[model samples]
Target: MSRTLSVLFILVCYVIQGQSQQVDQDSIKNLRLNILPVVFYTPETGLGYGALGLSTFRLKGEELSTRPSSVQLGITFTSKKQFLMFMPYEFYLDEEKWRFKGELGYYKYFYNFYGVGMDSREEDKELYTADFPRFRLAAYREIFQDFSIGLGYEFDGYHVLEPEPDGLLDTSLDIIGKEGGTISNIGFLALYDTRDNIFHPTKGWYVEGAFYHSARWLGSNYSYQKIELDTRYYQQIKGNVILATNLFLGTRSNGTPFQDLNYLGTKRTRGFDNRRYLDKNEVSLATELRFPLYKRLKGAVFGATGTVIPSLDQTFKASYKGAVGGGLRYIVNKKEGTRLRVDYGISGDGGQFYFTINEAF
Candidate 1:
């Protein structure tokens, strides 16, 4: 039942922008403001949490070069300590509009939870220690004028404080791979956007599809395959209001050795963790009404629903899976109608609040 799509509040992924086919007549030191806030909750893994995050974007010229790059920073807050992260994203484009890009990223999650959110058992008092400094590398290429492809790899091997005598205890809650463990994954990514631009969302369609697998130094002894599909549409309503609708469909293979069921996260769901429940397939739908109130203010209200199954063939079980929620939204950049956002939602168990940039497409 973990297949229910939940949108955790804080940090997540990025959809790369390829090299443009044509140059702009003029360009400038374009600036973009960004923010992301997330929170996690689970009845089985104890009470979970999210990181505190703030971000900004600075790009030199939109017309001077077909390829562009951006810089980002983020932070995470758990039960123990604090964490910081930094990222640099670079991209290239060819005459045929084929886009090539790469990204470097690092994240450190500091905390003191010796044993939390691990499993169904709570009797063991044994504990281990660890600190992780993960390095991530990603590349994206644009193929077929209508389709863009992407790939990413990362290795995280911080440290486990010290293993306890019980033989099965650790300091971190991550079960897929612990602090002493190095988790890595490679992905096949693609996106199709029929809009004026990727950042400035006006009116058009957007679609994203990706497949990912993990290995040893990359992640415990398990390997998993995930297929995700997302689609969105925007329409201008009367009185200058806009209507937005989005759908997400995803599924994971149960063959992964180090992985739990794929819990839907921020991308498709609005109020759940990536591992709350486990299932093979998930489906989500969301619709919103947005109104620009000021030059820097916009408001929105939306509803979302999703469900997960152990497999595509068993997608209709009504057991302990999935979630649903609805909440209000605030927008920045009413002029171009782009920039930042804040959201709040209520699910089957509780409610969640989140903040971020872009239109959530």
Candidate 2:
């Protein structure tokens, strides 16, 4: 019952200004700005309208071979009276030896939650409204070719604005985070990336592992730990044809909050409701076949399977979910390989459409 259609009107403007004469002349020091007005529809949000802006630029002495850094901002409001504002950015500094990325966002939104675990029934769905502010920051220094290690901080202040009367969230004593609270965590990150291009990689591998711990001493209401591993591979098959695949594994300690539990049906799974299943552990694998269609336009077909388990011992006995989808991509920034993506996915429950800025992985 989830769907989105984003009509994008793009405006691109380039600004060229000289900094100090001391700046390196070999650097490409121009800024490119793209603005798009977006309109979309979803059963949960009704009709939504928004504006998305992206600014891409290179630092003073950075070479063209280095990936360009980008800052993206978005604001949206729905007819249902929900709204969201977010800013996400990525920077490649010091000749691409240092990488910094994160997101800062505030959401006044509604989410559907079923009772936790794979056994949760579809009929048990409940809608809840919440407002929250989120901040995440990570910095990594390349230790070797295509390898880096880093540290990150994450924080979220979540408050429930509305909960269904007599619903599971209101009555269930087993549910943690039913009455939202602060979530503060510190984490370690390791990444090994060899992609030819940041936006659209035709060949390479990207592997990342992260571990995070949240404790009362860290200003968290609950104490828990989380571990996640995401691995991706991309390869060119033939002329203008590419194959991309991803596998993600995640697990959390027993004390993890319900909101922090592993779930399918996000950008990761795409076809089910958001947080369709929740549990302490999860495994998902997806693959896509990408090929050129026309000038500035590309096409892709993707399939994914995933499952969530309440405990590690139950992993082998878990019920799995599957999704299949196809989408179109329009190259928004040809030089940087940035694209506008629109995808429609189908699952056992139903189908959903997604509109976004980049690849799901």
Candidate 3:
């Protein structure tokens, strides 16, 4: 079976098993825990198996109105010798006045590289393997209603195990991070959010801006600065129907690694291969229409357009890429409004599928 399909089947099994499992609840601690097994198949990975544990809780003295915090831990290994271990957590403290979120993980994985610009051709695609340990942490405190200022630190120790001989990485002396290296950065962010719901917003605005710098003094192999801005708006069109729009902007300094450059594809731009187009600057815009399909089920149609360029001045002149797609959502946690999302996107090259546990943005 195809990798995506096999994963979907496993997720379906998980849903069935999840419904029958008894959640461990501690009333005194206001915590609930669920543990499950993961299994899937794919041509590249052969058989993959893992375990996942998730815990949701409210801090002591925190009112029920405060958002519930969650921590997820997972470990997986595949027959082809790939493996991953990770912990991701999000917490709301002080009655929503403070928020903290981050992830720590290590993984051995493969990625497709197709040169590093909008003009890159599909024929240049090459697969490479790498292993990396990553750490990311962010803390935010609301200064006033719905406005927050934050600080964050991130680290990634990347080691390329295999690079295609005679390929771009091997042939190009200009490519930074060709051998993989450490990326450490500290950043500051400002956010303004008014969305009524974090999982599925019906109406409101979310705007965020951040700046980070990685330098030799900070244990980074390369020195560079990056700036990013993301803005989103949601509006209720009618009963149970909503329209959402997003715009993203990013730029990095000269010494930035190719892997760290802004890209045209990610969760932000569906339908295209991940990091299909990479450069020093990028601008993207997307919109989605969401509506209820049935009880606890939702549907969405989205479109996006973006471009990557070496500099901001060339943004308008750069070749643009676009995509259109649709997706389904099944609510998994009613209280938290979390949903299992499945989307299929189409672009000039072909179709791409995505499956996950939350909205793209």
Candidate 4:
């Protein structure tokens, strides 16, 4: 537990983005601008982080479905860590409101550490730098009442980081040979989400399924030939309460491809280091419970478990391992439709506590 605390991470408050045009009757459409600012702390890294994000929407008169499209831009910075992100995305809604077409225009992520390799002997220590440009184009269709199915092609990857000097541990990663590679998966997907609405804080169930082929590219896990299945569920207990869950099952002919692209920090599991469980085959599960404490303020509790096996050839079962904890979520702005979520949870293995955004799914 001391080691976890020693990492010096700060609690992070997640703020969602942007708005719709609320204007008088206009020409073909109305344009609106939406922006969001976020601040967070990492108790493990003793780091402070901030983000500014914006979105532009085109509305067709008062039809709501007349002009269905939006563009987004965002940037992130940190005080303790040097990592940053610049993202731009575009989305489109069909005239019938039955489908959503979208694409992430650009995604640029830069990762940096304060004291990585000071070893004078290792020349590669200086080469420690990672960044990537990624994008995805997806379309969602209303399969049932509020349920939906989605399909798309995605390309995400890591900018190459240089090898560490011999005998020196690269703070950038675990395996010494990892150079941070690019991964692209062209596939199909299906999803179902019913959360009252996409803009405000209402809860329901959300499930997703995706399949892709790496075609021997950076996206290929061990050596291409990969498939992944992901599912999620969110429920509102009475009215002000919520419960969330996540499940993932994936494998590649050689292994899985998307696991290695995690270049930033621990996103899901608290007890284990980020990307610690990447293997030929992987399975993971997580859950969370939340309730509203007061106007603009909410609290939550969560837990998680996951593991990786060497191959699909061998049948491996999950041991249901993870963490548990709780935190507060403040509805920072009603007009902005933004919420600042700060959650803390501990892992089952060592009961390590962690705090972060959303529901950890």
Candidate with the greatest lDDT versus the true structure: 2
Output the worst ten-in-a-row residue range by lDDT, candidate 3.
16-25
Q: Which tens-of-lDDT digit does each residue in 150-189 have in candidate 1? A: 7766455544434554454343344444434445667777
Q: Lowest-lDDT window of 10 residues in candidate 1?
A: 111-120
Report the lDDT tens digits of candidate 4 across residue range 1-361: 4333555544434445334455544533445554455554444234545554544444443355333354545555556454555454444355434455544433333222322111112122122345556676777776566666666766656655543454233543444225556666666777765554343334666666666666455443334555666676667778777777777776655433333422112545555434433455656677777787878788777766665555554435433345566777665445434344554445432334443223355
Cα miss at 217, model 4 (Å)? 9.3
Candidate 3's residue-wise lDDT over 225-267, tens digit each?
9999999999999998999999999999898887688987687
lDDT, model 2 = 0.83
lDDT of each: 0.50, 0.83, 0.81, 0.50
Count of steric clashes across candidates, in order = 29, 0, 0, 30
- Give a tens-digit lDDT track for model 2, residues 171-262: 99988888888889999999999999888889999999999999568788878899999999999999979999999999999778787899
Candidate 1 — which residues are off by over 4 angstroms? 1-28, 31-70, 76-79, 86-131, 134-138, 154-180, 215-220, 257-261, 265-267, 318-338
Would you estimate the TM-scores of all the predictions?
0.64, 0.91, 0.90, 0.68
Runs in model 3 deviating more than 4 A are 1-12, 16-29, 32-42, 51-54
